[model samples]
Target: MTVVVGTVCVAVSCLIQSDPVAGLFGASTFGLVSAYTALFHTPRLLALCWTAAAATLTVLTVRWAGHDLAFVVSSALLVALVVVFVTFAGRMTIWLLDADIFHPNLDALTGLLNHDGFHEKAATLLTSSSRTDDRFFVVAVVNLDSYSLLRSLAGTIGVDRARIEVARRLRDTARSNAVLAHPSDSEFVIADLFTEPDTSPLIERVQGTINAASARLTASIGVVCTPLAPVAKLPAPDVIDELMAVASNAMYNARRAGGNRVTYVNDPALTVLDAPPTDEWPDDDTR
Candidate 1:
């Protein structure tokens, strides 16, 4: 679309204007089209548009500027340079703005996505998976058990180290495509789409990983899994929030019953299932 529009505009400007130089000036309107592409489209498309504009301008200049080879070459070169500058400048500005905006969405200590970042990425993932029949969305909320006690004993620096360590462990345990976030000092959230509905092995792996981390850290994990078929029509943000809420509730239940346990909830009714105790980590005191 950009190439077609730019070509037509360049051709019309060159043919209609009486002065060839003025016609070249009029064709500079292609910069507007280039600007649009730079803002909303990829760099590749922007480059393609620029290339087409340059070619059209060169061809028209040669045909219209009779006997003046210098004018023909100089005018085309000048207009193409101006368009190139505008397109690249606009792209750089957009890149800087995006970097500035996304900085706040990351946790400073753990370098993980914060709550807002998690919501944005999770919503996008869910929306993309809505049409897939075999995919399910899984949301897990993890709270480090006895975190306050650890903080008091270890002091600020120690607590920060522990948080970083826990974040690393969680990152290692989670799948590559999972959206992992450190929303609070003691809480982390993981959301992802899975082809298989059964997440028992994943949950257990997370529990085991946290248990193995330094500072004797154990986490209460709450998970909610829902098939894409039932909630495909719902808004992605709302669905993510609902699932997180249910998972948080289950996490609280696990913490209340005894920490270091996994609680699973199956949505949309939000049925809670307390997983049986595993002999792998028999010590309840770690919870």
Candidate 2:
């Protein structure tokens, strides 16, 4: 709607100025073109089109009219338009892609790592951690308590608003080395980015942060030690499947135990506990 109104405003301004060329020079036109391309074109195609258009326009102006003030002005306008379009288009494209990747449904309250983003990033992290024997890493799965009640009482939209608030709090509380992603409506994954041997302190810090957020908003976290026993014979991606499964189980135990506690599978208490079973859940419901 903003794009449409801006476009109309640009058209009207051009008509008032009686300069058909002014339409081409207006920022609103650039904004409109950028919005249109973002809605329709893929990133690669958008880049190619903008590149070609810029080149063609510059070349045409240089050849058709000699290198004079008019030629310079046209060239400048063309360059500005291309830059504006590309800059805005690229930014919006990435924002939309990330939204699709991490916050698809936009209803993820307690904004933790969504499942897809967690697996993808956790795998990458595991691959890297495997190379350095000295480095220690951890994957923490966070499960929110009574999230269904929150949604039911506040409505889905209200739940979403709460999620945004919670997400911001999580970000504020996350360690410098943490990679946070939401994998479920109320679950988040935090990948510790520490290369040092001590990660327990960092994990504690994250847990404390979440615990401090709201008395009503409690989180049960499961930590899985990465590069699980029996070091891989093959160099693989930086994700440890065993560790992920273990952390997931710990999260399940946390949930089962009334939610709001940090549990680690490697902990003595969970040593004999069975791994959490998996439940089939919808991958995406983003409108």
Best by the TM-score measure:
1
Runs with alpha carbons beyond 4 Å of true place in candidate 2: 1-113, 130-132, 193-199, 226-239, 267-287
Give the whole-model CA lDDT for all candidates, comma-separated: 0.81, 0.59
The residue-by-residue lDDT of candidate 2 on 1-287, one tens digit each, is 44445444544553455333443344334444555656665666545445544543444444434437575566557656665766677777777787777566443445455665566655665555444365455777777778889888889887776567667776887765566777567777777654553456756766676666643577778886533322322322323455566788888888888877777644222222243222333447642
Global local distance difference test of model 1: 0.81
Each prediction's RMSD to truth: 14.1, 13.6
| Candidate 1 Cα misplacement greater than 4 A, ranges | 1-102, 270-287
Error of model 1, residue 250, in angstroms: 0.3
**Lowest lDDT block of 10, candidate 2:** 268-277
TM-score of 1: 0.59
Query: What is the Å distance of residue 50 in model 2 from its true position?
Result: 26
Estimate the TM-score for candidate 2: 0.53
